[model samples]
Target: MKDLFDEIDTHQPERQPIGEGAVLLRGYALQLGKDLLPSLHDIGAAAPFRHMVTPGGFEMSVAMTNCGQAGWITDRAGYRYDSHDPVSGKLWPPMPDAFLDLATGAAREAGYPEFSPDACLINRYEPGARLSLHQDKNERDFANPIVSVSLGLPATFQFGGLKRTDPVRKFALRHGDVVVWGGPSRLCYHGVPTLKHGSHPQLGSVRFNLTFRKAL
Candidate 1:
């Protein structure tokens, strides 16, 4: 926690890919099917996705919800892992098979074949939305890798180091692109840059990101 997280409540990090692990697959998974679009609506039905507040009290630009054994939530209680949706007081939506299949496949393709993520953070970013740079240190275990799938309007992905002082590497992530980072790079600070204004025929003016992780 340095000057980095100070304005973390309001800083737009740069965009770049840190290493070879960051791959832009460009439409590699577009063949997943059109029904997948409505699948999100179903997922939201159970979780009732919302814009979560950061520990700093600022609202996140990205509307996030989850579907799995655990969901990521933040309130006055601070950012921590929870098993139930605060909105419905019920367990989060079940992770879809398509999502699980795609996640595990991407991990194996990235060389982490044994990945079994129990938490999936679904982010929806409309035009002008952005995520601040922060490490995924809240998870209970660091042994598992982070699997992120990007879809819709392209956004810059900033990957940094263990310390706030460390400079960042950025990459432009587009539809169907998946990035997996773990091992020596598992505890890195990463986030999305300011989303550009654009419209995707499938997702409209919004960008959907699936960040699959093993919370426990």
Candidate 2:
């Protein structure tokens, strides 16, 4: 992949507050972008991305895979986290050091210094792929914040209130952007809208999101 950091201007990291306990760290992950992709590629090779089916039997638009101690999955049974990948029948690949560092650093910067994630959900979105608004309540603990890193193409992120029908605010997330939400906003409904058709010089037409959470 080409070095996108070189093409973009070097600037101080900017923090944009999204809610009472949520923030958007603009260009916060650029420092680690070059190393992240290679580690992600290795993890994907071990446990390939697959579109999972929801409990309602509908297939998801985004392809997903995971690293660390647990991997999230959904099916007729329901949504839950498992130590083993259902398809491979083996433990999910270990989370890379760089991934852990990025997650912890971002969380700390967002005011959650004790965040230690056990699961990192990797979501791949192609043109037109989207994620529906949902809460991250499947995890056992709600105290840990969610650290989501955006890579490749840009996307529109929808952040809503506690209830599903609550008002929502949209934010434009570009490559190397990270969002952290915890405390009272940990269970807030959030998702990505349909990805626009565009080619990112480094990552082609796909957008990859790495969401770190404490699943256990």
Candidate 3:
């Protein structure tokens, strides 16, 4: 059987509008792939990725870690941003310059020029891991945009309207694709479906998502 990842279109970078304020920048982060991966490794070595439990006591399928000033966390206490890693009991690793540059550049390309993210939630998805449709509302400001970069295996991205029941549009997100949404689409619901089994040259069988947000 042919691998699913082999079918993904390795296209050139281009700006694609998915909503009023949301854009999928195809192949936007391809140039940064080399630098970003190594930085991700260092950050993971520092904080490590672990499955977090939701306030409802359900364990999340995705393994997560973070960099920057704050990290988004969920537990019995509820979903919120914390400055320290819950497991390490220390401040999250500093956001690398390459991460900030890529996020800022992508946000600008998506028409959010002033976006300066302070928190980066890194989610690692293995086969069968999925995320439920949800809104990112834990941040202090909705004026800032959300910048998400995809790496490794390809996955389906679910972007919906403001309501959970609203119609959702799925997009095939491959390595180096970046999605930025804010303004009218800042609070839109979004998620990932269960990832299919696949392997990548760099990341093996895992996929990584770097979500940048302004959480001060």
TM-score versus the correct structure, for each prediction: 0.86, 0.97, 0.94
- Higher-lDDT candidate among 1 and 2? 2
The models' CA-based lDDT, in order, is 0.77, 0.93, 0.92
Q: Candidate 1: TM-score?
A: 0.86
Q: Pick the candidate with the highest lDDT.
A: 2
Report the error of model 2 at residue 165, Å: 1.0
Output the worst ten-in-a-row residue range by lDDT, candidate 1: 1-10
Q: Give the range where candidate 3 is weakest over 10 consecutive residues by summed lDDT.
A: 1-10
Model 3, C-alpha of 199: deviation from truth (Å): 0.9
- The positional error of residue 22 in candidate 1, measured at the CA in angstroms, is 5.4
Off by over 4 Å in 1: 1-26, 31-35
| TM-score order of candidates, top first | 2, 3, 1
CA shift of 58, model 2, Å: 0.4
lDDT of 2 at 32: 57
Give each prediction's root-mean-square deviation over alpha carbons.
Answer: 9.7, 1.2, 3.6
- Please give the RMSD of candidate 2 to the true structure: 1.2
Residue 103 lDDT in candidate 1: 82
Candidate 3 pairs with clashing backbones: none
The reply for model 2, stretches above 4 Å from the true place, is 7-9
